[model samples]
Target: MAGFFDRFRKPEPEPVRAELDQAGYEEVLDLIRADHKVPAVKRIRELTGLGLVQAKDLADAIEEGRWAPFPAPGQSLADRVRALLSQDRATDAVRMVAQETGMTEDEASRFIDGLDQP
Candidate 1:
């Protein structure tokens, strides 16, 4: 089963590790810190200007305790979607869901629509 899934999966991206100035390092640290509200990928992009896969790989490494990014960026995907929807940003929510889950627009729409069910 693992082999089967691996065949379909995108090859893992190589990790990113950028040297940063104190202020720059601290900024990413704050973003990945236990209580920070900024998204990990966003912070990585801000610091290193890496593309999404690289940024996410770096963020994952930081999250695994290599860089004290432990408590993880204070928000979960569901919460983010809810936040966007609460702000009347359904389109943004759909776009975000599609990007994160690799779903088609129709599938992401249906997924978001599920959140509205009681």
Candidate 2:
């Protein structure tokens, strides 16, 4: 009799946590860098099936460096910094230079600042 009663109970929906593959992650990063965060969050929700709040949190995490994009193979650090600078991500460019080349933050800032000088 108890077994029969159990059949009427609805199963609870499980929360899904999805991890983005390289391509998806890269796309999200590009969207975020382009200042299209709404689209980025929408993409995240599509890819991960997360709710709006969760998707927004994920996008924020990516922006805050809780996640990192894969580096392009064979790309030099200088080239990468220039690319970031071109995207108006100067702070991120400076951090990348400092991290990869063991330069002080001040040195990295100066290096990035000098990249466009004649």
Best by lDDT: 2
Best by TM-score: 2
Q: What is the per-residue lDDT of model 1 for residues 1-118, given as tens digits with 9 covering 90 to 100? A: 7888888988876454564444564566557666563485787676666887776776765544334221227877677778768867687667667766789889988998888522
Q: What tens digits encode model 2's per-residue C-alpha lDDT throughout 41-96?
A: 99998888888998899899887655655577998777878877777778878777
lDDT of each: 0.65, 0.81
Candidate 1 Cα errors over 4 Å, as ranges? 1-72, 116-118
What is residue 76's positional error in candidate 1, in angstroms? 1.7
Cα displacement (angstroms), candidate 2, residue 47, comes to 1.0
Each prediction's total of clashing residue pairs, residues at least 3 apart in sequence or on different chains, is 0, 0
Q: Candidate 2: where are CA atoms >4 Å away?
A: 1-11, 14-17, 69-118
